[model samples]
Target: MPDDDATPRAPRPALADAVHEIERHVAGGGWDGPVRVFALVRTAAALDADPGLADRLPAEAVAAARADAAHLTSVEQEGLPQASSLEDLLARLSWPQTVDGVALVVERVVLPSAAEAAMPADPEEALAYLMAHPDRQDVRIAVGVLRDGGSWCAVRARANDDDAAVAGGADLVPGLVAALATTLE
Candidate 1:
């Protein structure tokens, strides 16, 4: 039998595509951008509810929606209020029945497990330590979760900096996935 880790796992098609699209859109702006939030709605349902939307959306997207029942349309949420942290932003969010899911895109700097043991307790010192860590990686994670409990994630490292290098899976970032799921509930 093939090693499970070596075997590739496919994420839910609709959610995976939506998450990747959002990741690409965000990546276009380059790095060090603010957190972005998006509302995921079934494309067919949106078009059915508002036929005029078909005219405004891209022709390809409309056509894809007609071809696939599971296609999702991601609407970027703007004018979000400032929050103390990402968790606080998520905590203040609650999707309506019309929204089928939610997605978040955020950039973070991460250090190796070994470096955690030496992290400073003070917030400023911790920030300095992370910045000075030679092994740190800057990554942007896009996580999407549906009301039905399906989740998908896309991670792009600044070093790799290529769409082809972006990784995808259902549980790539479990904590972020769970946080996004709560917004749907």
Candidate 2:
């Protein structure tokens, strides 16, 4: 006779596949603006995700990452950095070996310097100017990693015209793959 206490679990995604899915979601949403990313990792979980990474990380970094494992769980919605501050925060980060995966959030505008300079100073005029320029760009996207190294993302773009022009994920954010790689490394 079998016992009654059994629960089937959902299958987890492969780390790489999870990353790709996040990219796909962002692309589908036509995200275009600034991007912010965070990595959520566990040393053991990271090793399971990428065995090759075992050789690349320093012991200290791995220890630090493990110690910070609960960081993501404590983050509240208002606790996230403002979109404008994303770049500054990223510049200061140094990923450790215990990092299992990465998370990102972006809000950006892709406009030529000339266009920015040509905008009107008056609020009404600025609104008019923006309405007249269909090519003006603005996008926002958010990506996050699970403790197991799986990832997910959400995106929204301001204008459909500009949205159709940009690619998703790595193509959308420069240095993204490298930044993500740091965690695994």
Query: Candidate 1, which ten residues in sequence have the lowest lDDT sum?
Result: 1-10
Screening candidate 1 with a backbone cut-off below 3 angstroms (N, C-alpha, C), the clashing residue pairs are none
Candidate 2 accuracy as lDDT = 0.47
Worst lDDT 10-window in candidate 2: 1-10
lDDT of 2 by residue, 133-182 (tens): 75776756545444333334344555653434433332234254334433
Count residue pairs with overlapping backbones in model 2: 12
Candidate that would win on TM-score:
1
Candidate 1 to truth, TM: 0.93
Top candidate on lDDT is 1
TM-score of each: 0.93, 0.39
RMSD of each: 4.7, 15.2
Q: Each model's C-alpha lDDT? A: 0.90, 0.47
